[model samples]
Target: MNIFEFIRDPSQIGPWFHQLLLSAGMQEWVANLIGDVIGVLLIVGAVLTSAIFLIWLERKIAARLQDRVGPNRAGPYGLLQTLADIVKLLTKEDVTPDGADRVSFNLAPALMVMQIIMVAAIIPISAGLIGANLSVGLLYFIAMSGIASIGALMAGWASNNKYALLGGFRVVAQLLSYEIPLAFSLLAAVIWTGTMATNNLAMQQGELLFGFIPGWNILVMPFAALIFFIATLAEGERAPFDLLEAESEIVAGPNIEYSGLKFAWFYLQFFVNSLLLACIFTTVFLGGWQGPFVDQFPLLGIVYFFVKSLLVLLALMWVRATYPRLRIDQMMTFCWKVLVPVTLVVVLIVAIGARITPDRSINAVIISGANIVALLVTLGIIGRSLRRDVQRRKAALPGRSTAQV
Candidate 1:
């Protein structure tokens, strides 16, 4: 029994999928071990490559928005800037702050970086490209994000700095607040597609919506896409919601005391985390690489996935450039008061529509109309509140006398 025979004869490899290979030519354990090692290396390489590219792209985008050049000297147009930075950091000495807990501080960055890499492995980059196409892909992504928060808390606690502690608390709050609407929007997609695996959800949606157009989740559930994007931005701790790493306030936040490669680990985690959010956005809302021409030519699926994810990532950068940071109170209010109720209503409406229609597509006109109405009503209430505040401020000001006094 050779490797070929092992693959051909399924029964011989029942409990041990490679046992037949042992019987034929190669030892079963060796073959399995080799495969596992190869798989892990591939996953690590992919994750590292993505993290490097994303970091460079983010810096470039941020700089361009601010009318400054970013990292243009390290490599061609700073293409290899992140790599150069990594080398510089790696060569530097690791310095643990005297107040920091040595063990936990050393371990925190590894924990955060590892979990993100693990999550990255589960996302499908293209057809037949997934490391693990689990039934609970969406659930796994959420759970993995929760794990990253633990690392954040650990980093904050181990650093033994007040700023780090405060950053940790903020991150915990931020993650908890945004995770709700994020889950809700993804839940709508799950219900619509009838699968939790990202790849399957996208494929199921690739069919005709009303006998002609190939359906994307975005078209059927645009609001979900919008909510998911907002929540993901918050989750990624990007602008307007990036209180965790507010430089002027926290001075690098949880990794404040870190130096050398340890600091690099934290930086790497940030980029990796951004990529994870983009990947999830691609998975849940943008059809996970499924597109018009891609299905016809399977190779295009990979290109489609990267292109779509990059577009989403660039949009995130755009928001970071355009929007000011939300005050903590405003951030909280936006998540709970505005996003929560609206997403809840959206979910309910989607569920009802699904039950009633069964086979027909959801009425875009009805859904869009409802979204507009909700937006207008919320704006109207907010406008009224602002007007009353303005009036009160004006009334509180004293009238000027006849003279300059």
Candidate 2:
């Protein structure tokens, strides 16, 4: 069967979706394999395509913001930059470290890509666009995505590089720290949405927050959304939180020893990981494919979802360009000291507000207001502390003596 037939039928019988194909007796195995293979291709294709577009979009947005011309030479608006890069990468020689563990080193990138593609299969783009709407959809995503760290560690260890090993260690440490806030945010959603299922969470967004506004989780628990976004960026190893791959400090981090298509796989995984990040953000906070306009138009849901995801992706890229990465100490401190406390409070407030207020509007107002107050207070404290430190430093310095010299 072709792509269209495979997608339309949904009776394919691979291990991924075989349980659903129990009724198809004769062709079950063949059909399922076809289905699974197709599913994998579609997901991988989507990742690569998204990566290409995202690269172009990031450049365009950053260029506009920085008052410079971005990619416009390669194809129209330089849309094929990623594709070109892919071709170049593909033609390059694959290199393996002489001391590297060949088996694990080769397996690592494939494992990384596989894990990402597996998770992508679960994110339903449209009503019938899901691979399998498993009951434990959100749980599946968290659990499956967590496996990437193992791949990272394997890549680090297999390569026999100190920096790669350190990068892997840092990634694991960072992910562990940030995952708490991420889980807490998801928990807040589960409380508000009342279901762990992806579809249910999407449906919740259709419910009105007050009376007219669509009831996105963001409106209900804005703080959780903020925390989740930041934590996810850290989890995804994006900038400001990307101490794992800090180029200045650690060359190329975990994938430094990888070359050619193996390296390409790592890059591809990052892009796909970005897409997954966007989807999770949409599902958890922005309401998945559910939206006021999309409810009527149906097809508009895809547009809405993609647009929101793209905007978010661009924001991350912008952050990557604008912000210098934090020191490892600062990265850890920020997660443990700042994000953990904030998200814990957000979760607590969400629980209390959910108990007291029947109306989502009032609860949203209360929760969002509380979050804003906390943010402002934190900022004020940080500002004062920094000012005091600066003044003390100036006082201690040999100011006049140094100036004369």
Candidate 3:
């Protein structure tokens, strides 16, 4: 059967197989348990498979972006490079520092990875494929996203190395600084829907404006979306915000003392977190699974969901490939001076808009207009401030652009 049919009648496939197992003399409980196992295996398989593809894809994109060949020798188009690396890591020596805290050092990678894997529990792959349908799905996600930093700290402090300790401390400062704006941005959606349910948020965004445009959250709360996306860059610790792992400065950051498979987990976690953020961005702003014909052909929702998510992922890879890393102070200043204020204003707008119109569509339209005005106003203020700063700096300079003696 085609996807649409499978989606339209999901029970048909499951129940038919179940009955066949019963007819073949399997116990009902055994059959049910086997089915559940298969479902879980599929989910795990999908995550691992996607993670592998993303690793290869990121490298290929990085290579193309820089006009260089990357990983061509490992496999065709370098597709098998990640697997080869995994095998290599698996076989490498796991050297733990003598002074390291044995327990925390060992547990750190698993702690970091557990939170990322838990993220998949709430994400719906298709119309009816969520692992869990919690009412506080958004809250759950936000909470899960934050815990990974603790693992970094654990790794850093446990390493008993000064560099590792510094990296861990930086992780706290950076994550804490950016998470405020990120939380506020997400709160805009929560305020708009009056619920933290991921599925509900997606449904809310599925409406069309003027019968053509998809009423995604980005349209209604554009600033929130922008702030959230930028914060994802920080959260993922990608370029321009990757202070925690500045190789030249800190020498591989918190995972400095980790080696072999332990180091591999830390390395692979980067792509996994990227995928998670991309998925979250797709869900919150881009209208997860909400596209033309997806409503009728529900199976296509899964396809649309993935396509939008991958596009977000590609944008991230592009940023990672091109943008230069920011100074730690500059990064902190941007978060505090720019993103926090902007997202606060966006969240306030969302709240006021909700108060003005209990009507979802009307409130959305009003908020959309307000967002443009807010964005313009914000940019103008920041521009003038920056211009003044430049003038001040020029006045303080010992020489002009020619740098005369």
Candidate 4:
């Protein structure tokens, strides 16, 4: 391929590189092995490098929300602040508590980072651009993402500290509870799309509904998108669903006993996982790499994909800046009572809608209309519940009259 061809279609670069390796007198198997290693390294490097920028971006965003200057000294617009922090962390002494389980304590951070990386392998960046376009990519993601909680639990339990152990318990309660709603939300999309392959999901979304509207899952199943977004906040341990690491309660949670590079790994995992979840949301709901002129200029798909993912990431950060962390009881209650039931109803709606027609546009319209009704009904129910709870509280108060209540 020529420079312009590769420029217009970056997917060709991978195959071209492999071919180049073969032309360099390498055996087929050796070339394949080398290609695989390069792919893995590139993915890992991209994720880790992106975390640096994400960290700074989040700090700047949070700072602006709080009306303060953020990270302006280290580099232009404080771009190097995360790098400076990395240096400081590297120079700090690595510490493990005396009573901590040596193996588990050390393994936890690596495990957490590794699980996130594994999930990244399946994320479709653009058309023909993914580490592994597995047939069951969505299922693979759901499975691998769950492993991070195990790492958290291991860290908490092995820390040999009471507070850390409590954090571990919270991790179990929070992650496990949210995973159900998360999975169900994704299930709604799967039912509607009839595919679990990430690339196929994106490809299917490329078509415009009614010749104008983007055939994104978010439009067809808004409730699923909302539920998925909320569930991911909890899944990623972002506020207000950040009950696992509520510093006031658990004293830095599972990673309390970790310091230096070990702690940095946990920290890196958080930012990177948040970005990955946003990428997943973009792919599954926002029409990954689907945009105007994408067919004519395939490289534009990469641009479109990241732009959508960035918006999702900004939304996630906005929520973190706006909401206070929820209490453990409240967090669990919201997941089980609200998110879970709503997601189940969404799945049911999609399932019924899909059975109504073989035409995708018709199915989308049916599902979208049903989603509107479900959302309104859900909001009304929630409002009524809140009002009743307020009235009961007023009725119990000695100073409150029935009229006032």
lDDT of 3 by residue, 114-154 (tens): 87778876776555556666799988987886788899999
Each prediction's RMSD to truth = 5.2, 4.4, 2.8, 1.8
lDDT of 2 at 382: 70
Predicted candidate 2 versus true structure: per-residue lDDT over 99-119, tens digit per residue: 999999999998898888778
TM-score for model 3?
Answer: 0.91
Candidate 1 lDDT, 17-100, residue by residue in tens: 455446667876787776567668888888877778888888999999989998899768999888888888989988888888
Worst 10-residue stretch by lDDT in candidate 2?
A: 7-16
lDDT of 4 at 178: 86
Error of 4 at 344 (Å): 1.1
lDDT computed for candidate 4: 0.90
**Residue 10, candidate 2: alpha-carbon lDDT:** 35
Query: Which residue runs does candidate 2 get wrong by more than 4 Å?
Result: 1-37, 395-405
| Whole-model alpha-carbon lDDT for candidate 1 | 0.79
Which clashing pairs does model 2 show? 12-32, 13-32, 14-32
Give the winner by TM-score: 2 or 4.
4
- Residue-wise lDDT of candidate 4 within 203-234, one digit each (tens)? 99988888899999999998889999998898
Q: Least lDDT summed over 10 consecutive residues: which range in candidate 4?
A: 396-405
Q: How much lDDT does each candidate structure score?
A: 0.79, 0.78, 0.85, 0.90
Model 3 per-residue lDDT at 54 = 84
Scored by TM-score, the top model is: 4
The estimated TM-scores of all candidates read 0.88, 0.86, 0.91, 0.97
Model 1 lDDT, residue 92, Cα? 90
